[model samples]
Target: MAIGDILVDVQAVAKHYGDGETRVDALRQVDLQVRAGEVIALLGPSGSGKTTLLNIIGCILDPSSGRVMLDGEPVFDGKWLRSDLRRLRLDKIGFIFQAHNLLPFLTAAENVSLVLDLAGWPADKGKERARELLDYLEVGHRAGVKPALLSGGEAQRVAIARALANRPRIILADEPTAALDSKRAQLVMDLLRKLATEQEASILTVTHDEKIFDRFDRLIHLRDGRLVDE
Candidate 1:
């Protein structure tokens, strides 16, 4: 798709748990659109459904009611449109977390290469792709090191590389800078913005880090399970 194309199209999505009296609404009529090359920060207080919305967009969780389109294809309409949700996620979406969830035993490069492996790329080609991502993220020098040996920033960089391994059109990051200091958080947001521009990818970052708020192209506010203007 072109750089200005809408990569994510979420229409009146709602997510609720339990029934009637016991029902708890996590999201209510949430509609969102993320264009390619855009960087947006999703902000909200605790229990405001930020993660729920992100998970729904990532296809990791299903919504109670809504329709979703990714890369111009309908993926969900109350039920998943594609039977192979895993394959859809691998092909179109990337995810990063606050914890920098890297494999304990694998080197940084291996962690990245694993995504390509899952996507059915040849092992050697996967490794080369991992190397390229690590180099682009400026973590190539530490690619052979285990996660335990890296600093928080370094590990998160590795995680970012892993997220980029499949050339995904959209990246959903949940509190990616929560564990970092102010300076590091700012740096990470800057990196994300640069990645969005250079890769022409859409990035929706769920964050409470006011320090890095200015780095985003736009800020999306979530309150009481609904989106609101700043």
Candidate 2:
């Protein structure tokens, strides 16, 4: 991808936990670049640093060394600037996890609206945006339903709508379809790919499910905390 197309750039990044004898290298000189409108799958076995790398990219964790750039701006340079990093995570990055992690008490629209609220959007505007996202995700009818009332697929779609609530440029998903059946997993992957194209968002998803590999624009392999040729 061209330099201008790059949404996220991780240059020779490394992460080490603890110190001295107890120190463990979670990542080693990992380099990755994700461009806009692309869906990339991060494939690796357990303890391969997939989650660690994703967390670093998502601004949830800082690398021990190297730099991370978002939209051509440095977000992490050895140390993460707390104020700026928090804002960047809220405004530019969206995250999805293995579980839906929805607020059980809130309705679908409300669950999505909560994110906009945290971003300082006005109440009326947040509610409107939430409804719009639900409608777009084909879950408008379930807007008033609570998490317990929605099916697994519907809840997952709502969770996706929530991730898109901030209109983030980059999305980091960790095993988003791990709990779903094969058919449901396919549906979720299809929706994610569609979102990447239609929303022009860059998505880096960490997944162990090989069944959904074909849905990604690229597959990045990680082994022993280092990126390997695919």
Candidate 3:
């Protein structure tokens, strides 16, 4: 993809759950976009709808009303535009979470390989791809170790490698550095920026850690489910 191409386009999105007393507005008329090779941080308070917006952009959650475009293709408009959201997510989107969520029984390389395996790659090919990614993320030395044996930061890199295995156009991370210390948090942020730059992938991360704010190219601040000026 071209570096400046719009990879993720969210238009006038709104999301709410329940009704009356139980009503909860998760997002409100939100308009967002992430260009290829750009890294953006989504910031908000506990109930400020950061994750909701991220989920909508990642196609993990449906908005009450909106249009969502992924890699220049409409994937959602009021409802799903594609019947196979799972396939869409796998092919076009990469997801990272607060926890590494790596399989305890699998080695770091195997964890990354599993994603490629599910995408119909041969086991041997998947292993090679995993190694390449681990090497790129500077975690090659720990490729053979299990998640339980790896340090917090090391395990996160494995998780990131898994996310990148498919070479997705968009990468959505939710509190990716929440579990890391200040130094490690900064390291992960730097790695993400590098990934976006070299891979030409749009990166959006939901973060509460203010210490890493300076690491992002742009910041989207949300308050009461609405975008607020920074």
Q: What local lDDT score does residue 61 receive in model 3, on the 0 to 100 scale?
A: 85
Task: State the lDDT at 206 in candidate 2.
Answer: 96
lDDT of 1 by residue, 14-47 (tens): 9999998999999999999999999998998999
Highest TM-score: give the candidate number.
1
Model 1 lDDT at residue 97: 89
Candidate topping lDDT: 1
Candidate 3, position 103, lDDT? 91
The all-Cα superposition gives candidate 3 an RMSD in Å to the true structure of: 1.1
- After superposing candidate 2 on the true structure, give the runs of residues whose Cα lies further than 4 Å from its correct spot: 1-4
lDDT string for model 2 (1-230, tens) is: 33238999999999999999999999999999888888999998999999999999998887999999986778888887556677788898888878889999999999999999999999999999999999988999999999999988889889999999998889999999998999999998998888887777899999999999999989999988999966
lDDT of 3 by residue, 1-230 (tens): 69999999899999999999999999989898889999999988899999899888878888999899999999998889899998898888888989889999999999999999888899999999999999988899999999999988998889999999999989999999999999999999999999998899999999989999999989989999999964
- After the best TM-score superposition of candidate 2, give how far the Cα of residue 50 lies from its true spot, in angstroms: 0.1
TM-score of each: 0.97, 0.95, 0.97
By TM-score, the better pick of 2 and 3 is 3
